[model samples]
Target: MEQHKYSISKWCTVSEEVVKRFDQVVFEGEKGDFVAFAKAYYKTNEIDYPKFFKMDALSKLAFIGSECLLMDEEFDKPTSDIALLFSNASSSLDTDLKHCESIIDKDSFYPSPAVFVYTLANICLAEVSIKHKLQSENAFFVTPSFDGDLMYTQVKYILETHRAKQVLCAWVEYLEGKYKFFGYMVGSYRQGELEHTRENIKEIYRR
Candidate 1:
């Protein structure tokens, strides 16, 4: 396949809010209302979300953000090599806590199955794929800390195998209101930038 790297195909960015709202509908305050809070910037006097959809805030953000980026793309049947890779140091600690809290009291322990799902980082991918119909091969890895090298290798293998036309890679960690999201899409689009091998991905963050 032809390698094109330098050119950026599509790109967009969103944010965490004071509360995670679904479809602009408000959600519980504890999970990090950051995304919800950020909604204010986009909301105007004439436009506001009818209801927030916290169903899967993480994935919802990816779906909405990625789609908005590719809105004007003119690629021919573009396969979303746009793989999704997310990392969180907290590793769904909040979700686990919520679940444990549910069963902590044997007297009235009842775990909320819905909250149980967000405990895993990969759920973000599921939501993004479901929303955008992106079936590209991808992964979700967790670490005590961020290691750019680890990310580079995983992305490299995907490109080498022709499994991805591009990658929507990122670092999305959430615990309480204090969370971090660092992501970008990589692929062959530049006239000569497409040779996105392991080193290419690794070297990306070097500068």
Candidate 2:
């Protein structure tokens, strides 16, 4: 059997105070929260997506991270050939809390479809796909922590089975006002400067 190898072609990380692409600082927030930083980053980048403001925090974080991760890469393959694999700890609890509050009061209960739509954790994946026009396989896993091994295994299978020419993997966690997003593009070994390994993934997340 031939061993298949995959590499991380590009990576991006976004925290409340900073954004880094390929280990270089691209955006720095002045000790602000994720919301403030997100808006600032959007303005600085001049992103024309109007719906970005309407998305819940989880979707916004994942969207900004994906925007940075997939930026400037012209894909030779069709958009359907890219897969999205994301995992998170809070699993949309941030939005769940709001949704719960909206319905908690029976008399005042009026759940907004906009808020209800984001109750599912996987909704972030859908938002990203819509933004990027990716008609591809996508999955969102809820884990207690970042599980790089699981991501590696899943991406490996997707690539080996020709399900996708590349996979975009991310760990996007948002709860309350805290947010962290780390995402990378995985493709053939020749496509990247670094090998796709659990260690490398952890290292990038740490950075």
Candidate 3:
């Protein structure tokens, strides 16, 4: 059997303060709040997605990070062949807290269907998939920390199993007032700028 090799074709990181792509700073802002930073980023880039304002912090972060990473890449394969693999430490706790607060008081209870929909961390994946028209296999994992081994293994498995021709993998987290999102595109062909390895994933994440 021929060995299959995958590479990280492109990557992007978005936080409360900056948005970076391929080790280059694409956008920076003074806002210390995650929500504010996301809005500023969308505005600065002239993004007119009305649904962006409705997303929770986690989804917003994922959407922006994925958008930045896919901005310049051309997909020759069917969108359905692109898989989405994302994980985070906090999961959807940030939105869970808000949802809890909304229903904590019965007298002043105000349950919002819109807000309730974002309680699942995987909603971020849905938002990205919807935007990019990606109808592919996807998974969301929650770990105590960023597990490079798990991510590396999963991507490799997906490729080997022919589950996907490409994978948009990311670690997007939002907790308290801090937020961090890092996304990369992976594929079997060596058309990427970075080799897809656990070490390389960690290095770009740290940057």
Candidate closest to the true structure, highest lDDT: 2
Q: Candidates' lDDT values, in order?
A: 0.56, 0.89, 0.87
Candidate 1 CA-lDDT value: 0.56
> Quick one: RMSD of model 3?
2.4
| Model 2 misplaced regions, further than 4 Å | 1-4, 75-78
Query: Of the candidates numbered 1 and 2, which has the greater TM-score value?
Result: 2
Question: Can you rank all candidates by TM-score, best first?
Answer: 2, 3, 1
lDDT of 1 by residue, 1-207 (tens): 754443333333344442221123232232446555435433521223342255444544444444444434444553565677766577767667778899989999788878787777687777766555677787888888756677767766777678877777766666655554455566665663334445544444332
Mark the regions of model 3 whose C-alpha exceeds 4 Å error after superposition.
Answer: 1-4, 74-78
RMSD of each: 6.9, 2.2, 2.4
What shift in Å separates residue 104 of candidate 1 from its native position after superposition?
A: 1.1
Q: For each predicted model, how many residue pairs clash, with residues at least 3 apart or on different chains?
A: 29, 0, 0
**Model 3, TM vs. native:** 0.92
List candidate 1 stretches off by more than 4 Å.
1-32, 38-52, 56-80, 189-207
TM-score of each: 0.68, 0.93, 0.92
Scanning candidate 3 in windows of ten residues, the lowest lDDT window is: 69-78
lDDT-wise, the better of 1 and 2 is: 2
